[model samples]
Target: MANNTSSSRTDAGALVRYYLLRAVVAAAWVAAAFAIGVANPVAAGILLVLYPAWDAFANARDAQANGGVRANIPQALNTAVSAAVALGVLAALRIDPRLVLVLFGVWAVLAGLLQLAIGVRRWRTYGAQWAMVLSGAQSALAGGFFIKSAAAPAMPAIAVVAPYAAFGAFYFLVSAILLAVTTRRRGATA
Candidate 1:
């Protein structure tokens, strides 16, 4: 019983750190995107590629912190998918903005589903994963919207995706705060 409690607390602390890191990174990325993504195509393209690359890195790191890739199959797969999408976006940017949007749409859908799976799995062990679950659902929905937007005549700018990162930051912030609170409460009881 004591071991489980200690382990749970440790896991919660690690998750809190992960969430905080994600939140900070997302916030900074969104700020940079909004600042530079509208007028400069090159900057926008870089931001587009960076988004998924960052996701890949973040997911891989989170998986490693929690366990091996094998133990975190969803995140591992997400990392791979995000990395592939980053490469695809880099290659497709010269072709068309619509193509880039489509690629992002596909990536978002896959990553969101994987995120949902991770959240569900974590929820079974750590109790306060509601924010992550909602984030995943919203990300999937946003992905469909991105696909529809891509089909429209107007080209989508990188700033258009800033809201997605903003929402991710919000969810990560909430999750981090929730986990921190939970940890504190658990420690106090002990």
Candidate 2:
């Protein structure tokens, strides 16, 4: 029993570290988007394309670490979807932010739903997934907003996606903290 608890605590600690790293990366991306990527078209274009691609990489890494991609089907699917979106964004750049936003919207909705499923699945092992669940729901809603904005005649800028990134960072940070606290508490009781 004690060994089981210890294993769980160890797993939760790894999760906490992963979440924190994700949060930091997302936060840095947000900072770069606002500070440097927004003003320069080239920088903006690179940031736009990189976001989904990075998500693909992150999803694959996480899935592989937790289990094989086959075991984590949602994340595996998310990896493929995100990779496609990165390519889509690259293509859309030649057209306009309208197409870019549309692609982003579609990716967000699909990825968010997958994330929600992953969070639910991980709850049994990870114990503190509330923030991740909430983040997934919010991401879906934000995707809708992006889709709506894209339909407008006036083109939106890359700045539009930054909020979603910021929120993602916040949620990851919260999840990391929650996991750390929960794991420590469980460890004490055990």
- Per-residue lDDT for 98-142 in model 1, tens only? 888888888888898899999999988887899999999889988
For model 2, residues 1-190, the per-residue Cα lDDT tens digits are 8888888787788788889988998999899999988788788889999999999999999889887798889989999999999999999989876888989999889989998998888877877899999999888888888888888835334688988999999999999999899888887777
**Per-model root-mean-square deviation over C-alphas:** 1.2, 1.3
TM per candidate: 0.96, 0.95
Model 1 scores worst on lDDT over the 10 consecutive residues at: 152-161
Model 2, residue 96: displacement in angstroms?
2.7
Question: Candidate 1 clashing pairs?
Answer: none
| Stretches > 4 Å off in candidate 1 | 153-155
Q: Judged by lDDT against the true structure, how good is candidate 1?
A: 0.89
Candidate 2 global TM-score: 0.95
